[model samples]
Target: MSVVSTDAIDKWLLNRKWAPRDLSAPPAGSDLAPVPGDPGMPLLGHSLEMLRLGVRYGLKRYETHGPVSWVRAFGITIVAAAGPEAAQVVLANKDKAYSQQGWTYFIGPFFNRGLMLLDFDEHLYHRRLMQQAFTTDRLRGYLDRIGDVARRGLAGWRPGERFTVYPALKRLTLDIATDVFMAADLPAADSERITRAFIDTVRAGTALIRLPVGRWGAGLRGRKVLEDYFRRSLPAKRASDSDDLFAALCHARTDEGEMFSDDDVVNHMIFLMMAAHDTSTITTSAVAYYLGKHPEWQEKVRAESLALGESPPDMAALDRLGTLDLVIKESLRLVAPVPSLVRKTVRDTDLLGHYVPANTLVSVTPWVNHLVPEYWPDPRRFDPERFAEGRREDKVHRMAWMPFGGGVHKCIGMHFGMYEVKYLVHELVRRFEWSVPSDYTVRWDPTALPIPTDDLPVTLRAR
Candidate 1:
């Protein structure tokens, strides 16, 4: 039994008063429809089921109902659209017709107006300016920085030692992100505090009973503490430039020579911080898990890395690291970090010829698409060769490979993301050999971002 907070509900109710139409349910005869699920108390719909069971429950609904199913969660009706074609259409459409802001409103107070939440012109405007940080040169620079960080972090892993590696990857990525993006050296203790704060924030969002002083409340408070700290630090950062994403964004200028306002920088930084750390952590952990389970694949990747030989992989060599790339692609398909891509239809619109009434929430989950038999031959298998030359299974379906999302606001950091992941793999293969525990049964915590449920306990042996 998940609990809804009175204050949170009150806030929504009040916001609805000023924007009555936005709060209205989709007009009754919309072409799209919802799949029926186990009953809940009246007025709650299947909100509890959707939140508690996460993707699995929705998947069951899809299996029974069809590709598209509507169910209520968090006081709103979310239409989970499965299949590649439907996903392509919805993800391809941008702006007022589709609202990212509405879909992400649960964490709105925390994420605020970060690039991921911004829509239409605002999203484009900020994205264009921020794009400066992801240019080829910038990506190369980020790779150099991340490689160093990964080397340092992996140096601590002892051989023949058993330990949970998921949390360590999370910690590693945060430290890398803080250094690479924020130019901050956040101490281990402080970094741990921030990571725990984020865990509490996401946990608070899903807790069945969100009491006033509970997890969600603590998350909001944690956010304030974070915001105040960054707000004060921005001035100092502005005065001097550094080789980090924060300084880059702080001093970034568009063609028109406009710079980010202090508020914009702060909000965007918070969002980027979370996005970079969590997504990278999950994807990297997934790679480690797969490699540990499939030592053959690990050797394949190791050979690919070694062939690149002593010199750091240049763009050409990076592309030549086909096996390495395939491993990443396969791992991402198996365990998509951003499993569910969400949006809200702002206007009554037709998706895949099925009409979605105004204000209806739209979700396209990659977890299903990645495994759809039509796009993948043996969707459940962990085979990187499927992604090799002439076997591009992902190319079989347009939406088949969207771990970083698609369309206008598609992960601006995507290239940067791949670069970092590849670097982590390159370093891991070069330094250590790892394996999962014999009793390792894989599961995921899907509430916020998908992460290994058992914390990915694994055994490490130095190479």
Candidate 2:
């Protein structure tokens, strides 16, 4: 059984003094209800509580304030929009009111002007150009190349009693991202340095104290390292015809022949690397943990993988692994790697009955929405069958199981990310039998994306 921490801290959040509604008043004769909720623990608000409690914190807010509420955290007030109905509104963005400005509150400095941070026409235009890189022929080439990297990446693992899974997978995914996205094959020393830089920047997203200290400071420095490296490397990437994403971006164009600027190429490369590496690492680790805890599912998935000949399964083969697909889906719902589909409204909007004003930071809370009992059965259980054809609880609502987010800004690399996870996990189950102690539960750190604070140890045995 999984244990969720709800001790003194959880109780404190449940009973903390509430904050009054601060959403700006709607223009005259407007009927949009004011957004609501408690601001936990005074000035610090729900920040620490959120980092400590992940979904448990989100669940409590859903129960107390319903779909839309205000959360004071990271030194700002945010409209914490939750549930499928609210998700539909924000992701669809019918009025064009939501922009990447919400992400500006956090990762804008690090990932600024990358695809995810652009708004409306600019975003659509950039996306149209970027789409050239992910074409079907290009993805197949990426898969073939990534297979070699995955094999080499995992070749170092040996049977062990307490293998630290998260870090190892993190390193491997960074290698994959570097090879497939940037096409730069660096020496071990450089790869290690760049990997550390990525980690610092990712963790810095949640750093409330923005200064020349701690993770935030490291992130600032990391950004400089990347900027210098990319700027220096851009001339070569531009001159080449390499199949990697770096060259693809440098060469991609609309039919009208508009292409990325040098700065655009660098910005997109930095942000895409983070998006692919961190989220995949988080999702893969979650799947590994669940498969370890539930060996029956693991064995069934192994059988499916073994049934297909082991010589580097292609995209078609990866798609054919039914059991593994279910497991990945279940894992994604449980973890919600991206967690929040962030946005900030450009103007006033009614979010599921709440009055949210212009310039308000609003987010569609996939972390909380994925756990709502109305759309899921036994929201905390690890039942892959919830996604199996007959049950198909994900169909209960279009936004219910949206780990990849939705609408225009839905993850551009999602298909690629999914294939990458399936490929890695497929290879893993083929090579080893892994398990976790019956009592083991990941204590996730929500300081950034929800990652395991304990390193996620598991036992590994070669098959």
Candidate 3:
């Protein structure tokens, strides 16, 4: 594993004819126009800058070169699309020009054939069949498990000065996923191992050296662990008629008699499990950070949560927390769980008047778009009222606020994920009131999924 070098990976990729085409020449005297802007540095390109600045790098590039610009990153030239218009084009995918294969270059090794990785009719087919797992009845069952798990998890947290909320919330969400999705309660050691596996799998996407070295090697090992674990558990899930998501996927069928194979069930389970827990953890952590910064909003949301009584609120009751809903939306906008949506051109395409050739990687930056002043006024401010009835700023455009993505490939487990976050927050506010120092601001490490660099420390007082 240590023998594999970055240069070796690059050479291997090039030798296998899997490397991106070199688009160094200008498209002159042709009707099709070349994408404008600079590809920073050699080999590495703007990837280092992107990691350092996060969405701000895209915002800067957008400022210099219009909505559509080409930038080299992650060993390829990506057509960076900024603002809501670009998001509408890429996400809507009206012409069927874009393919989900772009994600294949990144996470496919770990989460291959996952729903997000499927394209065209195949994606629709699997999504239709999987819809049964997230129906109202199923979501309600998930909520029950979430509430019980949340209470148990929160009870363990010693409320006092300087608590790192992100890690606690991350662990809590993973536990909820294990119970609600897997329908099995493993011992603490096993649960911890599974959780670390998930973390490694996700973090693998942004490894600087794609070769099997250090963390990247662990990620490859973790993927195998997950594959073996899921394969081993498949028999039990299929034999039992448990209402958990694992069982649902095993038995899920469409009106047309479509059903997933055993392999399909295992693959989808791994992807869904990662998506369900990690995104929920990010959203919940952001909400906690914002609520801590703004006590007035915290008190307002807490009041709403308190009205629902002490016991865990059901899915229906959870929806009634309007203020909390606003906060969640704002938090999602602020710290998008999966910030940028990547797509590869299946054929030659025209995006915002710039010509993109086939097999090109196109990135639509929602994280930066969410902060654009034109779309979102006072973008940096933590104003949840932007999503309130009177404002409804998100309605400015169909793709303006796309934290869950849009069009055919929007997150299928969105409802369940939201319910999980709201339930956890409700339990959190009811049990303790937390706050961060006014002068402090979170530093998001955007290497993979956006996570706080400092683990999000805050002072917690028992209610």
Model 2, clash count? Answer: 0
**Which candidate comes out best when scored by TM-score?**
2
lDDT of each: 0.76, 0.87, 0.87
Using lDDT as the measure, name the better of candidate 1 and candidate 2.
2
Candidate 3 per-residue C-alpha lDDT over 350-440 given as tens digits, one digit per residue, 9 for 90 to 100? 7877788888999888898888888898899999999998889999987789899988999998988898899989999999999999999
* Candidate 3 C-alpha error for residue 205, in Å: 1.1
lDDT of 2 by residue, 292-358 (tens): 9999999999999999985788889988999999999999999999888779888888888678888
Question: Which stretches in model 3 have alpha-carbon errors above 4 Å?
Answer: 1-32
The candidate, 1 or 2, that scores higher on TM-score is 2
Collision pairs in model 1: 2-208, 3-208, 3-209, 34-70
lDDT (10s digit) by residue, model 1, range 1-463: 9899845663443222111112233457665532322223456656555554556655555665567656556666677788788788887884348878664656777778889888888889999999987788877777778877888888887665567888888888988888898777787688877877666655565544455577678878767866876798898889876778888889999878899999999888888888888888999999999888888888988998887787766555677777888889998998888878778887777666555777677888888788777778877888898887787778887788788888886899988888888888888898788887555657777767788877888888777
Deviation (Å) of 455 in candidate 3: 0.5
Residue 247, candidate 2: C-alpha displacement in angstroms: 0.7
Worst 10 residues of 1 by lDDT: 14-23
Preferred candidate (TM-score higher): 1 or 3: 3
RMSD of each: 6.8, 2.7, 6.2
Measured on C-alpha atoms, candidate 1 has an lDDT of 0.76
